[model samples]
Target: MKPSIITTLIIILFGLFTVQVNHRHLSRLRLIEVSLNKTAAGLGISRNSPTSMPKASYSSRSRQRHADPEVDIRQLANNLIEMVKMIPESESPKDRGELMNSLATLSEFSPSQIKSLLSEIHKSDGIDDELRKSVMGIVLILASDQNPRAGLDLVISSHDPNGSLMWEDAIINNALRSFANSDPAGALKWIEDNREVHPEVGQKENLEIALLGIAREQPGTAIQWLKNIDPSDRDDLAAKIAKNALSNEQRMAILEEINSSFVTSLDTTEMGKLKESVMAGLGASLDPDDFEGSTAWLENSDFSPEEISTITSGLALKNPCANTGEWISWMVSHLPDEALPNQVTKSFSTWTNNDYKTAGEWLESATDNAAKVPAISAYVSQIVFVKPQTAEKWALQLPEGPIRNSALKRIASVMESIYPGSEDAFKQRHGL
Candidate 1:
């Protein structure tokens, strides 16, 4: 009786243990399947088959999952080396050239890989023009990357005594365009140093572009270059070169000199063209007040329709709201009847309503009686339309008189229009 009971208990315990082990095994297998599905989705590969799992060594799998920087760098370097070696020495110039270009594309990797390939090309004496251009392309890419100085050094060292004309052109143009904006002085220096070896390297046009870039960073040096050009030549190209070299103040001085010296004797038509050129040059630099003054001067001066148009165009470049109320008044008074006060009011109303604070500041600074009326009206309209709460603040700032009364009336009118029978409600709400 005791043996039978013990055997039954043993069988029951073994069955329970097997059930628990099977459950644990099934849970672990499900987790693995979920992880594999996630990895497949991330890689944009189908997970419908068991073959979706990449076959690789354990170490390779670990490296792929958590990249080892040193191993990645070594593999990248090896790939670049293999690409370079594929360029056959005895192959057609075109084929060898294409392979070199492929090598240059590898410059997106480490600079060290680029340097190694370039050094090998330098050592090999028989490379053709196409291959040379590809090398320079790589150098340009490297110059645009972190180790620009190293790229520059490689370019300087690669000067061929018997290099083809196409090779020289390609190298110079690529290097100039890439490094010119990055470090203009360094670029100009390199060109200057190589001008003797490559006699036609730095032409007037090339030098001008380089100087313009340098002027953006160092104006004094650019001014010195301008001073070196002959006066007759300078007169011919002064507007073009000075357009790049001079600061805003210097440009104004140049315009004044041109006007005093040449504007008086010229015919109306020619003088008009010249004024247009000068105005365009000062388009971004002239202050809004200065534009108003210039416009006044043009109306008084013997400027033709063309000259007037030029001055007006320059004025238009400035934000209309930046013009003082006095200036706007003058414009309304002086402009043709077609450009009426209502038109100005409409434009200013739109601008003020758009929360253009600059325009608002200009409207506030306006002191002219004719200009102030429309400007204040437009501002009041803005408050009614977009910012009712701000209207009271504006009204309170007006001096006690017609202006204050007019503004208050406009605010009341707007409130009545928006909240009928609620003027008192608005007044109380705003503490008017």
Candidate 2:
């Protein structure tokens, strides 16, 4: 049953050839890894850590000559695509810097080259969703670099109207930002044109990205565009535009337009939101050091008592515990009876944390029991665990009300957990 000598020799040689082929294949893979690492280094990307590549503009590319023939765009793109295919599906490969560097390399390719690559990638069954989105993002950016309309069309066609994908918003926002930066009027026109066709494009946050970019360069045009949109959208968008204004003058200009434009009386809810937005914009614009100048702007406005209170709430939300003494004086003078308690509770809590002695002094000196009750409650809440006796003394000072009751109950709850029989005695002593 022994095989012929010639047959055995042939089998041995075949086995040796198989091992050599595998060695060559592994060597090719290692070479690719080394080449890519070198490419990443040249581009200032780290192969081991993820980094965002800046948007590639035509002017930026034009400055550099395409002198390296060995670094052919097509070849680099092919190698990166193959590397992307090797990444495990369950792993987040984008967390690796290689994919981002791959994108940087592919970004230099021509629109036609990008289109060809996209076609090939579309036909590729091995590419995962992460790689697919990364490639699409690069395509969208490059397409927008030349023509916003073309870029938007590619985005709309690739994405589903009803379903969301990872990086979908970022991809769209980046494209719109590039478009708006280059041509604000053109970007606005595109939105107006496509709002009906793609309702998703009309989302408020989406519009803000473009509007912010537009407002940066063209405030007048941005305002004119804002005036024509839905009443509901105008207030928030106007606020955002004002918030992002380049200078104080630009901020005031947008705010004045908002003040002048909504001449017709809006419903209660609309007016409230408008007031809040206006105050929020103003709050965002306030210079922390220029307290006098900042407060002067709001003081000069023709805001009603109710409107002032609402706007003050917005200001507190933006800048809480801002110069606690002066802040309390301003709030007491302006904030309505209904808005006072909640504002005091929140702001004083923050103030007590920063400087309890100063906070306690102010609370004791306050003439208004309305302010004192909530202020005491906030103060006690902060020190309840660390200084329970001080908390009890402060809590007992409050006049009979919901604020006083809540502070007592909080103290009792803490005591119950810390001292076994203390809850009942504390509750009975405080009249529950």
Query: Which candidate achieves the best TM-score against the true structure?
Result: 2
Alpha-carbon local distance difference test for all models: 0.49, 0.60
The reply for model 2, stretches above 4 Å from the true place, is 1-103, 123-166, 178-186, 216-224, 227-235, 242-256, 264-269, 319-322, 353-358, 364-370, 400-403
Task: Estimate, for each residue in 1-432, the C-alpha lDDT of model 1 and write its tens digit.
Answer: 122211221222122222222342223223223333343354443433222111111222122232233444434444444434443323233433343333323434355545555556555554445444444444443333434445545555555566642223434454464566778777777667766766555655445556667766554455445444433433323344344533454554555555665555556775555555655544434455565555555566564444444444444444554444445555665545444445456546655755557666776666655455566666776766656657767776666777666677668767788779867765565445
Give each prediction's root-mean-square deviation over alpha carbons: 21.0, 12.6
TM-scores for all candidates: the values are 0.37, 0.67
Q: lDDT (0-100) at residue 379 of candidate 2?
A: 93
Quality of model 2 by C-alpha lDDT: 0.60
Highest-scoring model, lDDT: 2
